[model samples]
Target: MAKYSRIIAQAGCHIHHAEPAQVYEAWTNPELMKTWMFLSGESRESEAKADVTEGGAWSVVNESQEETYRAYGEYLKIDPPERIEKTLVRKETGGQNEKIKVEINSILNGSQVIVTQDVVFLHHEQLHPKTVEEHLREQRRQTEKYWHEMFSLLSKQLTPS
Candidate 1:
């Protein structure tokens, strides 16, 4: 038996008034990350630890959540304010087993972040034979809407002479 899972989602925002650098900064910056990714008002804080070099380690920590996700992967490709690609995996899950690659691109008037997640089921035998396809689809829909709202807020703050 084989185990496989794939989910692709496309979400973008148009900050016609802000430069790509500004949008990119907001995307990668730790402060901005907490603002959007964590909303529990738990005083979420993160240390960038972003070398952003071709081959470097990137890490982030969420104190409030009491969780940490880190990765060590080479920058497959990077075009300033344009695109970024990397191979990553979840820590503390287990021994190195699965790999996830994420690519983000900057689009006209703003940027587009597309996530392609591939996961391998552990102990594929014992798992039930049920798939949450519709549930995942719904989740993607809600997430797209959420991004739209966040981008709207960013635009309001960014748009100015």
Candidate 2:
């Protein structure tokens, strides 16, 4: 078989202070999403809207100190507090098209959220597996960092004053 691209980046964490449903809501609820959505370290969300149903549309405007842009897509699958799969688009991705699958499961006293992005390759050239793996490792690390930051923000919002 010919390889067009190799893309697999995964990140997850166990938040012992939040429940599965609460963690899921952070991704499905537009309002909750706005609180943690970040384009950069100092960036914040300007707008977020989602229908939260299969085939429903979702969009977010991420504003950083340097720039602002919109990322929009549709929900491919939504399974309550267990899982969600959706398409995501960004300018730098070249509409490379990707499916972001978020899985939430109940843990000891909180929740575990795992996010995986399947990046679609645009170029039709065959790349070496080692090369692909190295690239994915860096991407995975960066993605994991972002998710952790987002979750931290969500946790703060869910905490009592």
Candidate 3:
């Protein structure tokens, strides 16, 4: 068996204008996911595909001028309007894989979305001289940035037309 460490990273944002169900739908719905999940300037030429039920799989590919990035995952648990647990694999560069848990809660009649990711570095030799804690902090920082951007876009999607 391979040894694994639970290097956890967490981030959260409050969506004042949307309900928990709307936030949950945005995450589970592939079409909605495609609109907000990629980097700031990348084009969403390809749509995301997802099986939102428990044990189902999902994938999304994003293309940029410099490179293409792919992310795929299997749903581990799905608690409607409340929580979702999944395993995600980034199929580019380092190919990092992680277990992700998302919780959507109603706060002051609005939604607060929290994401927790547990990751393992299988090959220590590949990392630089930086300590594991340092690397984890950097990963957490990057993860926070991505989620913050996605949530910003999600907020826009929930805005009134």
lDDT by residue (67-135, candidate 3, tens digit) is: 777778899999999999988887431555688899999998578999898866544554554565676
List pairs with backbone clashes in candidate 3: none
The parts of candidate 3 lying over 4 Å away from their true place are 1-6, 92-96, 121-123, 126-130
lDDT of candidate 1 over 11-75, digit per residue (tens):
66556656667766654565664444323235356454455666655554445575543434445
* Sequence-dependent TM-score of model 1: 0.58
TM-score of each: 0.58, 0.81, 0.85
Q: How well does candidate 1 score on lDDT at residue 6?
A: 39
User: Which pairs of residues have clashing backbones in candidate 2?
Assistant: none
Candidate that beats the other on lDDT, 1 or 2, i.e. the better one: 2
Evaluate residue 32 in candidate 3 and report its C-alpha lDDT on the 0 to 100 scale.
Answer: 88
Displacement of residue 111 (Cα, Å) in model 2 is 1.0
- The candidate 2 region of ten consecutive residues with least summed lDDT is 119-128
